[model samples]
Target: MSYVQQVMEQAIKRSPNEPEFHQALKEVLESLEPVIAKHPEYEKAGILERLVEPERVIMFRVPWVDDKGNVQVNRGFRVQFNSAIGPYKGGLRLHPSVNLGIIKFLGFEQIFKNSLTGLPIGGGKGGSDFDPKGKSDNEIMKFCQSFMTELCKHIGADTDVPAGDIGVGGREIGYMFGQYKRVRNLFEGVLTGKGLTYGGSLVRTEATGYGLVYLMDEAIKDIGKSFKGATVVISGSGNVSIYAAEKAMQLGANVVALSDSNGYIYDKNGIDLKTVKQLKEIERRRIKDYLEFHPKAEYKEGFEGIWTIPCDIALPCATQNELNEESAKALVANKCFAVGEGANMPSTPEAVKVFHANKIIFAPGKAANAGGVATSALEMSQNSMRYSWTFEEVDAKLKDIMVNIYRNASSAAKEYGCEGNLVVGANIAGFLKVANTMLAHGVI
Candidate 1:
């Protein structure tokens, strides 16, 4: 068997029951065949084997008291996957679905994602299987404190700086940062996505979503296409989805749909992102609540149906594996020309294959959704200097970084004789940097 196949088999054998991590590894490793051939020294140094294994995995128990005086317990995890390039950097996701395997998958993806940003941050992810929905503010604060009490010991401003993910947002970050301060007794930039008053950077809120559109705008431009007057379908109603819709509409695309965990709302007249931001950001309501504002709009119960709305561009900004083979075929049948992932591994491997087969412009999450972490690095710089930039300044820098990411990925693809295949391009481009850094570090 080949080196890549050998690593795949061995990794799966050693780490069974981690299908998410396996899937992530498969996607990246398969794309590294050309790179591996070009550098047999990488195999000699066992870079592939070490790359898949995390440097450290921390598991702890979080015990907190709810508002009703009831004690609750949840398992917490932080997988510090790699730090060859720089310190560990990723997000802490809070949800009922969080587990070691899930965090591993996210951290594995983060290594490449952070590397693609050309920033001095490594890969790590931490979270718990705690559900925050419908929880009282006190309960959430207690839980955040408990989670950070342990997490703070393993991270630092210069060591591992975590941002927000899925259920963990400004509120959670605030609670955790406060707790980290109380526990460590030192206020520093240990986390990104902080409230603006507390060392947060501008443009951080809209980075990922806007960055996705920016990358897509660049990719489609190479093919004589743009978001101008194009029909766009974006999934998720959270920060990423809302901002992506906002930017796409600003760029003249008609955003027809946005969804949440419950269902999706479609408006052929173009989605009013103002109402969406109000509902999701302020009211914390479901997408169905959107119809209450616009009676003429349509709401569907199933999220999978969102892809069938027929659009020129589809941005999957939801959770992992949210888009499957069926959804991919549906989008292609509708003549969708581009699919940009605003979420980590939002599209399945099979779905990616379908897009490639149809000659669709597929921007992998590591490249397309990198704006969030890229901006997080920017936030880190601001924190280090005790200064912040204006919104326009940060946004301009973000756009430049995103454009460079697209150019680097495209150039990498062309160099590897796979021009127009951004999946391979992004993977190769991201891996080479980390791999060479690992080599320089001398098997540490």
Candidate 2:
């Protein structure tokens, strides 16, 4: 076996039961064969080994009081994967599915995602298995306080800066930031995704979803096409999905479908973003409620059926492995031309193969959905300067960053002979920057 294969085997064995981490490592390492082939020193210097191993893995217990005065407990994790280029930067997910494997997978992906942004942020990820659903505001506040009490010790503005993900939204960030400020007694930008009254940026709320569209726009244009008059089916009705749908419609695509964990809503008349925001953002109701307003639309009971909807473009803004080989094949069968991932590792490897086999323009999440972290880094810079930029200014910068990200990944693919394989290109392009930085800084 080759050196990369040997390292990969050792990684899987060392991190047993971490299937997500294993999958992430395998996918990243698979593309890096060309990189290690050209630079054998990467193997000799043990950079791959070191890169796979995190600098720190923090696991703690969070105890909070619910509204009923019941003491609830949850597990929390913070994996600082790499800081070769700069401080650790990523989001903190608050969902029941959060585990060591999931955190590790996200952190591992973050190393490359942050690198692809052309920013000076390294990679880290932290979150808890705490479910924010159906929790009262007071209960959520208590949980955020308890979670940050332990998290603040390991993070700083100059260290690992965490933002929000999954269940961690603006409301959660506010609670956590307040707790951090209380305990740390510092008003630094230790966290991103804060509210506007605080140090948060204007366009931060819409960055990731908008950025995904921005990257997809560039990809479609390169192929002599555009989103104009196209039909789009997007999964997830959360922050990323809503904004992606909004932006796609603004660019002339009829966003026909969107879903949540429960089910999906499909309206041929195009989804009403105002109702979606009200249902999801304010009312905090399931997507099934969308039918109450759009009586002409169809509401499906299963999340799987969302993919079967005929559309020109598909955006998987939901969680990992939501789009599998079966779904990818279904998408191709329906003649979907593009798949833009707004969530990390949203498409499985088999799904990726299916897309490539069909010649679909697949934009990986790291490059397409990088707008969130890129904007988080921007928020970090603004917080450091004690200033903020207007919505237009930040939006423009985000667009440029996303366009450059596509070009860099595309060119890297061309350089390595992968041509249009953004997966290989994104992995290699990001790994090269981080690896070279590690080489320059010398192994820690």
Candidate 1 residue spans exceeding 4 A from truth: none
| Per-residue alpha-carbon lDDT of candidate 1 for residues 1-444, written as tens digits (9 for 90 to 100) | 999999999998999999999999999999999999999999999999999999999999999998888899999999999999888999999999999999999999999989999998999998999999899888999999999999999999999999999998899999999999999999899999999999999999999999999999999998899999999999999999999999999999999999988889999999998899898898888899988899999999989999999999999998999999999999999999999999999999999999999999999999999999999999999999999999999999999999999999999999998999999999999999999999999988
TM-score, every prediction? 0.99, 0.99
Residue runs of model 2 more than 4 Å from their true location after superposition: none
Best by lDDT: 1
Candidate 1 matches the true fold with a TM-score of 0.99
- Report the Cα lDDT for residue 123, model 2: 96
What's the lDDT for residue 437 in model 1? 96
RMSD vs true structure, all candidates: 0.7, 0.7
Clashing pairs in 1: none
| lDDT, candidate 2, 102-128, per-residue tens | 999999999999999999999999899
Of candidate 1, the 10-residue stretch with the lowest lDDT total is 277-286
User: What is the lDDT for 234 in model 2?
Assistant: 97
